[model samples]
Target: MQTAQLHMTMTGASEPRTARVWLHRYATLSAFCTLVLICAGALVTSNDAGLSIPDWPLSYGRLVPPLIGGIRYEWTHRLIAGTVGCLTLGLAVWLQFADPRRWMRRLGITAVGLVVAQATLGGLTVLFFQPPWVSTAHACLAQAFFCVMVSMAVFTTPEWGSRAGIRFSGARTTEKLAMTVVAAVFLQLLVGAGYRHKGLGMNWHLAGAVIVTGFVFWTVVRALRYNATESGVAPAAIALGACLLGQLFLGGGSLGAKLYYADAPQPMPIFVYVTTVHVALGALTLASAVVLALLLFRSEAQR
Candidate 1:
């Protein structure tokens, strides 16, 4: 044990108490950057600004472009994406060296890989003139990347590694139900992405919304009921519920705005704002479900 500790210290482990807090903050910032990236992507789509720069990995052969018209949105989105990619890379490397858990190191690597793939897909979406499939895939991948960041955030917490395992009755059943809710939310996001990009999956998206909403409602109730025993359940459940309600309101506003401006010569600002917010809220909902599910499972496991 002394030799292992010596190796860990020499290999840049640093002080655990301070390093853990820094890791948590790093993960949180990565998640926030990802959220901003999602909003920027949404704005690009809602405003029909995807092709504003007409270049991939560059804007008109320059790293920076004049912030004008659609170029502002597109360039700013690219900047945010680049920043997120860098942050994820740093977090992954930091986890590999500083975090003791092998699984967490692997997750960090996976996040880096996903960020690279996501960036490639974003470029392809532009190079291909925003093909429906590519763009939809890009959108879906953004949510996946966001989920990864959220997981990293959760795992970095002191409680995650040190909490005493307290098994409650029906723990397995609760985990399974939470898993269902997470899956439903992800599927609904994918369907919604398709519908947003190509109008090809609105019916499916609507059906999925119903299913996801039901599962979310079920999950929230279970969490609340389990709150008497599990201290972690209530907060996560409340966050998920709030996100769901916001998503519902944003969805309605998006639809209403679209219909109200269906005959306009140009897309109205309100429509753009509503649709972007809807997309952003959808990402948040998925992240919340993912975090809640992971917390439930983590809480149930015997540490």
Candidate 2:
């Protein structure tokens, strides 16, 4: 009888563990799909397809439209966005039932809310013929939604819950600096988005880039120097550093491509590719800084 009871206890315990693992994996998948959706959105903007469909919640008065010219890019972006919305909704529902943490459940709900807002903004961008401010907000909100999805993915990982008590000196300072870096990166993204939509000038975006790069380096160097051995801190810091470097190169390439294609009747393929990649990498840089900041804060809390 004792053996049977023990077996049942083991089975019951294993189920929740299995569920957590699946939940983590699902969250990670949601984050990845969000990134892909960002890329698709970037592609649409780069290809000058924002108003190709001339309709929202439907393409050309139908669920699917004839995918031709810029219509292809715009329609594909919409389809991918729809898929992301479904994934986010599923993730939120799963977290509500399966996760024990109240904050995480709340975060899932927030993710759902952000996705809804993002979709609405996307529709508005089309309906209003891509007004600069509206379009820039749409771009910025996508980055925010991406950050939320990434945070969920990181929080759900087993490592996040079971992290060792790895304390480090100056953790508070590191956390503050990391938070600064995140803010800088986000602001730079805002400027870049504004520049892309022509609401702001290239000079403002360039100035923001320089400021952000300095902040990123400062945070990264501090984390690596002091918290190099911390479980999550070092890796996230390294990623942020790498992403910043890549973004710089992509930024230069994008500038050159834009100038080269300035006289072209339409956006050249090279221009589209470079600018889209720059935008995608910018999203990645912001996400990396966010992860690093969160991990730093978690470490400080554990201390």
Candidate 3:
């Protein structure tokens, strides 16, 4: 009888562990899908296909329009967006029932809300003929949603829960700097989006880039120097640094592509490709900074 009881106890304990692992995997999947959706959106914008279908929630008044020219980019973006929405809804429902953390559940709901808003903004962009301000807002919100998805992935990681408390000198300063870096990166994204949509000038975007670069490096150096031994801190800082370097290179390439293609009748394919990759890399950079900030804040909270 005691053997059976022991077996049942072990089985019950293992069940939740398995479920947590699956939950984390699902969260990670949702985050990856979100990133892909962002890339699709960038492709549409870069190709000037935002209004190729001239309809909302459908293409050419059908479930699927003929994939030709700009229609293909626009339609693909819409389809990917639909997939992301479903994934996010599933993630939220799973977290609501399976996760024991109340805050995480709330975050899941918030993710659902953000996705809904993002979809609405997307539809508005199409319906309104892609107004610059609306498009810029849509782009900005997508980045925010991406960050939220990333946070969910991080929160669900087993290490997040099991992290041993470690004392890091100047943690408060590091956390504050990390927060500033996140804000700076986000603002840079805003400026870049505005420039892409013709709501702002390239000069402004360039200026924001310089400011963000300084902030990112400063934060990275501080975190690596002071919290290098901390489990999450060093990795997050390193990731942030690596993303910054890639973003800078992509930014320069995108600028060159645009200048070279400025006189072309339509956007050159190279220009489109470079700008699309730049947008995607920009999203990754913002996500990296966000992850770093979240880690810093988490460490601070644990104290």
Candidate 4:
């Protein structure tokens, strides 16, 4: 036995079965809650609701705001963010003080780090007026950290983690291809973020989702060409394809609005709504890539 495992065995008294069950339950709930928090923030951007409050850590100079009218979206997003922050903070405490596995303890620490990093990114977004790189990185990190949280949950749960034997020898060729598609999709997401922040390319952004369309098409093509039919990577490929189609319509709608305003008596409408949806979905593309990467990593670990 490994030294750590040996030590654990030697010194350990039995943990109450019920206690372990509760811990597993808590981790499972925490993971799902964290995922919901992630989607809430995504919608904040999707609806151009970030600046609705026009302040950080407070909405309209208050910690809590009336949730009537459009403030509802912004305020609700904030409330959910606060709740998520607290839940993760609680999860970290539980892991540190209660969880016995050495690796899980480290993962809890990593989760804490991710929370801190995410908060800092949020602050930078506010202070810097939502710079594209910072915002996109902030957004991408949330999704990445969500996956990490999911992994932690997976490791902690009894029915999930203990039985899934590691496979270190598997379809090496397919695994590498899946990994490659994920990397390309991640790059495409970053590029799409850059495009969203482009001040001069409003029209092109609307018309130019063709770029990502081709990328997703390529990703799907490759996934079909390589991965096992039963693997999770195929769904990610399908998601990329779906998101790309949505991008085309959202991009065109945004650009169409811009051109329409250019001809109207009123000022040009803000492109943020369309832009942010594209931006948020772009994050989704990155996340789908991340999941595919996880599948590849799983395959490699098993081998």
Candidate 5:
């Protein structure tokens, strides 16, 4: 028993069960809430409803407004954003108390700061009547915040903590591939954000799609090739591949729906759903890439 305790302490894996439970729960909740917030933001963009309220931190000079017309989408988005901010704040505080790793506590602090900045950018988007650049920045920052929450969730997993000292062979190649995938995904997301807001980078976004897809597939292949030796890599890589495929399908559907609406000049319900979902899936893809990269390159004890 003493030997086990010593070994666990040396491995930095001596988390109490209750603390781990709370931290894991908070992390999962934060990640889910962040994803929902991203979806709401996408809906606002797809519906062209960012300025529907015409107010910052309030809707029509009131706390609660009737959920009618464009106000429904815009106000709902604000509400969700506020909820996500609170959840992230609570998560950060919880980590400060429950998590043993200094880096994780710091990550929580950074996430709190990001949520505040993201909210401020969101307000700026409304105050400035949704300037293309400001709105694009808001979108980009939201993705960053989402990535942070996802990382928190990953860090709280038992598997992550237990694998601290199990260094995999071929880690260099895995690191390079993971880093490339993450970089390409983020660059593609930035181009997508710009294109979504102002249509200024449509060509660039299209070009980036090709590059992101190639890197994503290559990363998956690399992980799978080493799966016999590194079990965790294959699962994460496969999940990333699934997200990439979903994004590609949504992208195609969005394009088709847009072209159809362009000629028909009619309301296309599917178009909004497709485009918004595409945006959400893009964020998911970025988060997955980041998680895979961190898992491949960094140990839990290192964090």
Candidate 6:
């Protein structure tokens, strides 16, 4: 989730201090931890444990009361989420001081804002009794925060800034197309995650996967046809495209194969694991695609 790749770069600036490197390192780690938090929240939904806590911000009215805890599944997720939120808040403050870039600082602020909003959504999910849209928004916001965090990590590296003379063809058309994919994949994920959380309407999620498949197919084709860059970006588009296609197959097959075989006599564990992998890969694909698109647009804009 730490941007496109971690190959690092040939930095001319006498590689920054250990502390500076540590800051970037923690920011990336916190962001990834947030990603897992989102997935954990999804698992809570999948297991029907969302309301098991039944109380706001306090696990049964006490902070350090119990680790053996009530509602093993639900309260545990809350504790993890609490940890992630604090980590992100720390990262936000650290970014403000560590990176002097105004835009970067603002992005950190926006990330924190998203964390707050997502926390509010989580509370509403409990207070309102698991409204679908609210839960979906919570999931969506988590993805957004992940996207920004990865970008922050990328920008912090010396190779990304004014060197490499790297220019992207942000041609409005391509940029918009990429953004459209980001929006499409994100929206589809929202629907899918909501379904799994609410434990209802497999059909709806399957339908979403189908629709997302179309958008992803078109995205790959567009990148292939018009994106002239054949260096770093070329591989990104290919890798992204392949992952999307593979995800579509895995996600669809997970549900379909489950139904098909379950109706018979016995089914393989593949069904469950397939779904798990689908969801995990879905997160990965969403993150990587957005990063690729942002890099594409950023490089293009500088030209």
Model 5 residue 114 CA deviation (Å) reads: 0.3
Q: Candidates 3 and 5: which is better by TM-score?
A: 3
Looking at model 3, residue 224 earns an lDDT score of 95
lDDT of each: 0.84, 0.87, 0.86, 0.62, 0.82, 0.69
Query: Model 1, 93-172: lDDT tens per residue?
Result: 99877777777889999999999999999999999998988998999999999999998998887667554243545667
**Please, what are the lDDT tens digits per residue for candidate 2 over residues 1-303?**
434433443455665667777989999999999999999999999998899988888998999899899999999999999999999999999988776666888999999999999999999999999999999999999999999999999888866654423354565777778888888899999999999999999999999889998889988999999988776789899999999999999999999998988899998999999889899999999999999988877777676
* lDDT for 35 (candidate 5): 93
| Tens digit per residue, CA lDDT, model 5, 1-303 | 534533563465645554575678879988998999999999888887787888878788899988887789899899998899899888888777666667888999999999999999999988888788888889999998899899889888756654444244555776778888888998898889998899465789889989999989988887778642553666778889999999988998998898888876444678889999999999989988988887776542243
Among all candidates shown, the one with the greatest lDDT: 2
lDDT of 6 by residue, 60-175 (tens): 78764344422665776777878877987887788676554567778888878887888898889888888877877776777777777777766665545433233444366666
Each prediction's TM-score against the native? 0.92, 0.93, 0.92, 0.66, 0.90, 0.79
User: How much does candidate 5 score in TM-score?
Assistant: 0.90
Tell me how candidate 3 scores on lDDT.
Answer: 0.86
Superposed Cα RMSD, model 6: 5.8
lDDT of 4 at 209: 50
RMSD of each: 3.3, 4.0, 4.1, 5.6, 3.7, 5.8
Query: Could you tell me which residue pairs clash in candidate 6?
Result: 168-299, 168-300
Cand. 5 Cα-lDDT? 0.82
Give the poorly placed runs of model 6, Cα more than 4 Å off. 1-12, 15-20, 64-70, 163-172, 197-204, 221-231, 257-274
After superposing all C-alphas onto the true structure, candidate 3 shows an RMSD in angstroms of 4.1
Residue 45 alpha-carbon offset, candidate 1, angstroms = 0.6
Off by over 4 Å in 3: 1-12, 162-171
Q: Which rank order by lDDT, best down to worst?
A: 2, 3, 1, 5, 6, 4
lDDT score, candidate 3, position 19: 71
- Per-residue lDDT of model 4, residues 61-122, tens digit only: 78888676556766876677667677777777877766656677788888878878887887
Index of the highest-TM-score prediction: 2
Q: What would the per-residue lDDT of candidate 3 be over residues 218-272, giving only the tens digit for each residue?
A: 9999999987776578988988889888888889999998888889988788988
